[model samples]
Target: MGVDRSMWKMNPERLQEHLQLKNRARQIPDKKKESKKRACRVSRRALPLFPSLSV
Candidate 1:
């Protein structure tokens, strides 16, 4: 369902805030994937220094 027009008419600022939040929510996943990849690379690099850690 679409957002109700009356809601925006009642509080225009709420509509702006909702749209901003929606946009930010869309950007979060890509950042999470990049961070996970970086963590994996760091762990892989460290594993060679402590060979016992590798399985």
Candidate 2:
């Protein structure tokens, strides 16, 4: 089904901008996953020091 013209006011630039924002939204989760992996790596490396520091 085709979208209604009134929805975007026939503005092609608005449609392109909306598409670009959608693409950026899709990339955000991948960046979050990468940062999470880095955090997990840091925590694993620090795990050994915890027990010694606690005693």
Candidate 3:
């Protein structure tokens, strides 16, 4: 089987740009995780404010 030459048309610089964008997308959840940790830490003090609903 012959290799496809069409896939190699991308410029090296463009490939690097795409890779950097993908890496930044991967790091987004990490920031959210840190915020969630802070929220959980503060939530304990606020939990009692919401009264439990009886069915």
Candidate 4:
């Protein structure tokens, strides 16, 4: 039987480019990481303004 080249939905070169783009995106830090650092900082700033709540 002949190989079914149409079985591949994407062209091989385009598929490789798409995968590389995905890997590049994975290296960037997203908003969740930034917001987590900001959240931890909130208590430090809040504690100064609300001294009674800090107890």
lDDT string, candidate 3, 1-55, tens digits: 6864654786999767877887899777787789999999898877776577632
Model 1 global lDDT (CA atoms, 0 to 1):
0.79
- Whole-model lDDT, candidate 4? 0.81
lDDT of candidate model 3 versus the reference: 0.76
lDDT for each residue of candidate 4 in 1-55, tens digit (9 for 90 to 100): 6864654788889878877887899898899999999998996787687679878
- Model 1, 1-43: lDDT tens digits are 7966665564678878877887898877787788999999998
Could you tell me the TM-score of candidate 4? 0.48
Ranking by lDDT: 4, 2, 1, 3
Instruction: Estimate the TM-score of every prediction.
Output: 0.37, 0.37, 0.38, 0.48
Regions more than 4 Å wrong, model 4: 1-8, 40-55
Q: Can you write out model 2's per-residue Cα lDDT over 1-55, one digit (the tens) per residue? A: 6765564674788878887886898777787789999999998998886687888
Worst 10 residues of 1 by lDDT: 3-12
Question: Which candidate gets the maximum TM-score versus the true structure?
Answer: 4
Cα deviation at 46, candidate 3, in Å, is 16
Taken over the whole model, the C-alpha lDDT of each candidate is 0.79, 0.79, 0.76, 0.81
Instruction: Supply candidate 2's per-residue lDDT for 6.
Output: 64
